[model samples]
Target chain A: MHPVSLRKIAKVYHLDAVTVPALAEVSLDIRPGVFTVLSGPSGSGKTTLLNLIGCIDRPDEGEVIVADQAVQSMSDDALSDFRARHIGFVFQTFNLLPVLTAFENIEYPLVLAKMPAAARKKRVLELLDAVGLAERGDSRPGQLSGGQRQRVAIARALATAPKLVLADEPTANLDSQTGAAIIALMRKLQREHDASFVFSSHDPQVRAEADDVIFIRDGRIAGVEQRTAATQERAAS
Target chain B: MNTWLLALRNLLRNRRRSLATLLAMVVGLTAILLFGGYRSNILYGMETGFVQQSGHLQVQRRGYFLDGSDNPSAYGMPRYREIIDAIQRDPVLAPMAVVVTPTLQLGGIAGNYSAGASRSVVASGLVANERNHMLQWNDYDMISYAQPLALEGAAEDAVVVGTGVARKLQLCAALEVANCRQTPAADAPVEAAATGSPAPDDVLALSALEKAQQPRGAYNRIEMLAATASGAPNVASLTVVKASNFGIKAIDDIYLAMHLAQAQKLIYGAGRPEATAVIMQLRHTAQMPEARARLTALLASDFAGEPLEVLDFQTLNPMYRQTDEFMASMFGFIALLIGVIVLFTIGNTMGTAVMERTVEIGTLRAMGVRRGGIRRLFMCEALLLGAIGSVVGLTVALMVSWFINHSGWAWTPPGYSYAYLILVRVWQDVPLLVGSVLGMIAVTVASAWWPASRAAKLQIVDALRHA
Candidate 1:
């Protein structure tokens, strides 16, 4: 079953008197338990499309159905609740609250969900151990390395056990080795948790780790490639 | 728990800004408390001075105030004893004293004879012991016989004189001969008198004659006869016994006390010895209204067809009101200035904090914290700052006030000659401290509200993007 469905989605920004189209009539369906990468060069509307799917921004004219709820018609507050319940987000900057420790950052989503204290503690500890940062839970974001910080962000994103995770260039700041490790961790968590992971990236390492690839040029989808078929095609060529 | 903990953590994250705001609140609250305390002290002092020195009510002969001649003989209230007795029985009135002293006031010829000449002076007489009591009650010293030299034999009419009177007489020593210049002969013309030797002025003459004729520096010894009751005379004279460097110099120099019986006898004669009005002390001033009303009714009924006036300190003395109003205005002005300073400091500090924490506030909002929660967070911080500041400020103020009270700083009030060390009165100052502290808290919280609300209302998107 599809976890996220978008039909003819569009987003426009009014800069002064100019109307800039960020996304134009885009349509797609994302199923559960699959790793998908949306790949494009700069200004190809990859981030905008991710933002729409993440419910942080709304498409000007479109139907965005997440977990069978029509997100396009939801109020800002309702949409916030929806995002908190179903969509976990990872950003390029590893947006951890500087004042909070790794454990606190991971527990933040659970707090927003108002989970019981015991449950929150249990979930946070589980995620911290899962991210291999159980020993570093008390350390603030500034005390952690870039790879560790990204790992903490991923742990925080999955703490609420969200069904759909949107990662916008999550490994853009990490070294190739750290990047591959983070991607592998995310894929492993997805398979175990039965959650779908969607990454907007131009990085080859990120693209290679995906199960399916959606390529875009300008503001339109250029093509889609399945991993097994693409591998066979590449070998044949 | 998580939101509040996050809020607290965020506050500590920006240490310098938070500290700056806290410091401003503390200083503002402290100043307010101190100023309020000072004002209360001054007001209490003034009120106590008023109540103790001046009774809530006074009874006088109807025309005594207007004529400036309130002699007991001329306007005697025949039932003076009855009135005093009646007032003393009342429960609410705190009457301190009920005195019926005679006053013999006259612009008369006073003289002292020596071998060379006799000098002229102004003489006044009062009921002695009672006069001394009145002076002492108002914190004045008793007079001594050594200060005014007594005359002998034919010149036994020796009198105590004010410094001003002494200067006028030009007496080198007490009871020494100071001659009066004789009046020029009017019929012989001014030219003849200027040419003739000025005749020696008569030392024995009446002040009544001095009034009838315009005499030229002629000294008269008005042998004013004052009768005294058998034993020690009730009159006690008040000379410049020991002139202090402080307090009411005019009364010190000019006042004279004589026996009440003597004054009544000399001024009113033997058959009619009476007092103009009676003074009474009650239990307390709070009972003054009922006491006054009861007294007035009694006087009206008992002394039918007679005119009497019941006057209070507020009515008899105009200066008291002026002093009270001036002190009140001074206290008010000081309080206002302090309050303004506190308000501005807190406002500025909170404004800076709100500006710096835009992003943190946005994050909280995005995390499902409501606008009201943000405002509450800021208010709590303000309250904490105010509470801490008030305590510190009160401690400092108490210490300073203590130092001042014990500093041995002395001052002589205007119209006074003696100096007294300054003292801080705690009973009068505690309320001031409380009021000021509360005022500081109020102003600090009020000043912080607008800025905190502004921070709470910041757009989440823009704030999240803020660098």
Candidate 2:
């Protein structure tokens, strides 16, 4: 089954008396265990779609099903549990709690899951090594470089082995070299953890590394293109 | 790491704001504790004073507390000595009774016959050694001691009059009294007697022969006049041994203390000697209720048909209760003021912290922490501040109280004519210390509730976008 599927989902925002339709009747399916990109320019509903798939926001109409469960039907606590177990997210700013170290930030989701300390520590250490931040585990977010913070964020998203990881503008604030490194690290982690990575980006280089690219404009999906086996293999490599 | 550790770290992120909030809490808490201790001392000091003077409980005739001062002999307990003995020997009260004795109250006119001046006075006749023992009751560790009466082995006719009486009698010089002021009218009688001039009726009525018998200003001798039990006038010649200050203006103006035998003779000559009150000083002030209960039971059964009623020191002296209530009200008002200050201080700090951490809160929520967890995190931080402030505040309060106790500062309280130690009592009072701590914590948590709730109810996506 697809990790996430949306059917004619819509979202709106009200600023004072003005109503802005951020997303309208968007339909998509995210293939399991693939690196996908929702490619669009600013205010193009790409991040809105990522938020809907992450179960962080609700749609005004239609259905959003994640891990084969309709997310909109769950209570807030149940939805939180669902998100903690089945989904993870990465922000453009790498929103790690500033007070916690990189290791503690990666262990946060597992702590939410109430994993025992021994198991949480082992899992956090393994994820830190996987993200090339094992030795920098004790460094706070303020002490880490942009590329290093993004690597730590990727490890945190995959810490619970979630079925889907949604990122919004994952490289918008990074230098080109750091951006390319983060993109490569995310792709490698997706392959290693076998979790679907659906991130929103406007960068052509970023979209070029995706197994699937969905283009959207004006709150509606414009197109979806799936790479061939050779192209997917090359992208994965 | 644990949630508390996370909360502590979050607080440490903004050290200045957190310290400001903590300082507000600590200052408020210390002020509250210090005032609370001072209030305790006032009540304790007054309690010790009353117990030392009038014993913890007194057994008096019915209607005595209301009207006996007007004519105390009418309500006199004729067999008070036997009653005191029974109380001292009773199985239940024997251990608690530190001193059980009888006191005689009489109203009379004290006249310096040689000076040709007379003023109305109220006198207490006390067993000198027993009265000295009663003056030594210091149950709350007041660190104060009363000077024993100087009439312990003096003649039965010796007496002590207040400085006010000495001033009115124009005998301040003879008694070696200090701070005594004599009115010009006080010399009118003596001056008239010396010049053979006309004088007021009180001075003119005294026989010239009596005034001539004693030299003017040569001796501290006074004549006491009181109506005997049969309503016949009786007079006694007393040698004034001392003029003491009773620390109350009105009581001092009319105060006299003499040996019991002399007072009984002056009031009930050739008849059964009686006592106005059976003073029972207890080993501890806390034992008053038990001692009173047992004494009342004894009076009802063993000394029936005497119209006797038992009264505790607090009940007998309503001023103590009034002062206590007044102090309590003032303390409550000050405590409320400080509590409000602390409340708003902590609230503002938490409010600012919530605003600064909006995106962090959203991240926590996205990482699967429930709203309750968010609320608890902030509340934990606030409570930690309160707990630390209380402990440190109490420590500071105790230190300050100890310093003041040893500072030798003294000030007269209301209704007192002399100054007393400015003492603050706190260490042995567990209820005050524990209640202050809990009250501070409760205020801290309550203050944080609104901010914590706001943090919890934040829209995740909106918070993530906060700048």
Clashes of 1: 26
Please, what is the TM-score per model?
0.66, 0.91
Per-residue CA lDDT of candidate 2, range A115-227, in tens? 99999999999999998988999999999998899889889998899979988888988998999888988888888889999989988768878989999999999999899
Instruction: Report the C-alpha lDDT of model 2 over B1-467, residue by residue, as the tens digit.
Output: 77899989988999999888888888888888888888988888778878998998999999998987657678999989889888978999999888888989999888774566778999999999999888888888885536677788998888988878888776787788887765444444555544223444543344343456655654687778788888876777788888887777677789889999999998989899999999988988878888888889999999887899999999889999999999989989998999999999999999999999999998888878888889999999898888888888888888998998899999986666678878888787778899888999999999999999999999888888899
Candidate 2 regions exceeding 4 Å error are: A232-237, B179-218, B293-304
Backbone clash pairs for candidate 2 read none
Give lDDT per model, in order.
0.62, 0.86
Those runs of model 1 whose alpha carbons end farther than 4 Å from true positions after fitting are A1-11, A14-19, A23-39, A44-89, A108-119, A162-167, A191-200, A209-237, B1-11, B14-30, B55-355, B410-428
Model 1 over residues A1-83: C-alpha lDDT tens digits?
68888899888878899998888878988867788899999989898888778766678998988888888888756766777
Q: How many clashes (backbone N, Cα, C below 3 Å) per candidate?
A: 26, 0
Cα displacement (angstroms), candidate 2, residue A101, comes to: 1.8
DockQ of 1: 0.19
